[model samples]
Target: MNAVDSALCEAFAPSGVLRVSINFGNPVLATRGTNGEPQGISVDLATELARRMDLPLRFVTFDAAGKSVAAVAAGDADFGFFAFDPVRGKEIAFTRPYLLIEGSYLVRSESHIQTNDDVDRSGVRLAVGTGSAYDLFLTRELKHAEIVRGSTSPEVVNTFLRDGLDVAAGVTQQLLADAKRLGGLRLLRGNFMVIRQAMGVAKSRGDEVATWLDCFVSEMVRTGVLRRAVARHQIGAMSAPEVKP
Candidate 1:
């Protein structure tokens, strides 16, 4: 093992605390609270992992999921929790999924756009975070809807909030949370795509950690810890766990 891995092993050998990195952009995953401390589903899950492992926890935040995954690959973080994708799989090892989520279009409640069908019409523009999975998904699925890409979710949301686009397509979890807070935005009842969320570790790190994480995630799902966390956070877009094959 390398120095970082050796150090991590030594660190965990005594206390079992693992240093994990997660994206703060997705409120359902990790985000700063009013007190400026980290909070959210991934944060809770990380804490739970630490508890189950009889270890303390360390957290590192990134602006996006891609960044978080990159951190894992660079050994800057031990692991990451984010949506799993085939493209990302080539770069990192991923645990079996703990949760499923879908993407949806968010629109102002007063806007006439009410469905995916509505978004297919010409002249309708959908805002998305540039270079994000949502952007790629929207590009593939919505041939007729013009895409307006922003660098961040807040930028995309703000553009849509200001009427710059007819809709904003994002993860349903975030859309629902934004709807609750902003009042004017609403998540359409239907989904555009389904995504599985998993923990990612560096590809170079061998499968030991990934195997452990996968087993832990399976137990969390079976014991209702995953469900409780989602419900407690009111993450409306998350789907119930699927039985592992």
Candidate 2:
């Protein structure tokens, strides 16, 4: 790898290890390995980022994107992988997305909700992860349905099951995993939103490293490293985003 700017290095991995907050809830992005190691597309990319920087790697795991974003905002981690959201823009700066995932709704198999459009109806109760991109989106868009909050993204499916929710809104991959693991759960045919998965740092870090991360992600995608990681993770029905201009 080419030498990196020393100042950027100090700013990004001050503790020697490139500390990256990773959300394990999004199955498309990350999951546990056979030996209980962190494993997935994001983990592979984070490892690659550290390797390129010649920094040791440390992953600070979280069950939710909100917690991962909070770690970035609080400067507890050098950076984190999360869905890009305007609400998070207040405290953190995110690079252009390296991946795109779909947001969809899950419902009981017996329900009449065959499409994404069928979910937003009166008396419908939707379970969503608190402070998540899906929650943020549904809060603003679902006029008739009541939004029920789960502590984390992975918990949304549980909440939906326990509460007999009319719909469960979250990452499509997450919904798919739940649908497969649990009986009588199915996803709406189409996605309700396209989630931009990006890396983030505290807003105070300024544009220099953010710009570098943006470029780093693009290079990873262009070089096929990211796409390969996605394939290894078995992330179905998704694609690495086009490099941001």
Candidate 3:
């Protein structure tokens, strides 16, 4: 490889191996296999990036997005997949989004909450995963509602039910599955936000690393690597369109 490429490799794998932070919090990107191994679109992309870099790979796994972000931001891992948020942007240098997943809310079937607008009224208790993208988003946007913190995204529904919160906010697909599994719950009409999922390295890695990561994601989309990975994993979220110049 050329000197510039070698320098990037050394920066990315400073400990002699690429450690990727894999978050199982977002079902669209990753999940545990029957054999208990991490499997999904994020894993496929991380593996491909390592292969292309000719670097040995390792996964630093977490069940929560907040932990994954912390690991990468602290330089405990070389890379991570996360929903792009301005709050997180302080520590992570993110690529343009590769996936667009809807952020939605779920409510009990008999609850008076009827629409997305109704969710923002006073006295409404909304449960959200602590430090999730939507939690951060809603924390900034919701004017009157109270946001109750769940330990992780997957547990948002449980927290909502356990605390008797009025709504559970999270990824649409995950909430849909939770509503189906537990019953008596319905999603609020439409979505509250569209989560822009992307790969990131710590800002400490420098602008060059962020630029290269963006190029890598763009090439994956152009060559249909992302398309195939989504199809292979049976993810329901839409692929984000390439950002035009």
Q: For each candidate, what TM-score against the reference?
A: 0.81, 0.93, 0.97
Residue 222 CA error for candidate 1 (Å)? 1.2
lDDT of 1 by residue, 130-227 (tens): 65567766677777778987556646677787766788887776777678887877777788887778877777766666666677778778888888
lDDT of 2 by residue, 25-47 (tens): 77778888888788888788888
For candidate 2, report its TM-score.
Answer: 0.93
Each candidate: what lDDT?
0.73, 0.82, 0.91
Rank ordering of all candidates by TM-score, starting from the highest: 3, 2, 1
lDDT of 3 by residue, 1-245 (tens): 22338888888879989999999998998999999899999889999889888888999999999999999999999999999999999999999889999999899999999999999999999999999999899999999999998579999999999888999999999999999999999998999999989999999998888888888899887778888788777778888887842
- Find the 10 residues in a row with the least total lDDT in model 3: 1-10
lDDT of 2: 0.82
Minimum summed lDDT over a 10-residue window in model 2 is located at: 236-245
Top candidate when judged by lDDT against the true structure: 3
Comparing 1 with 2 on lDDT, the higher-scoring candidate is 2
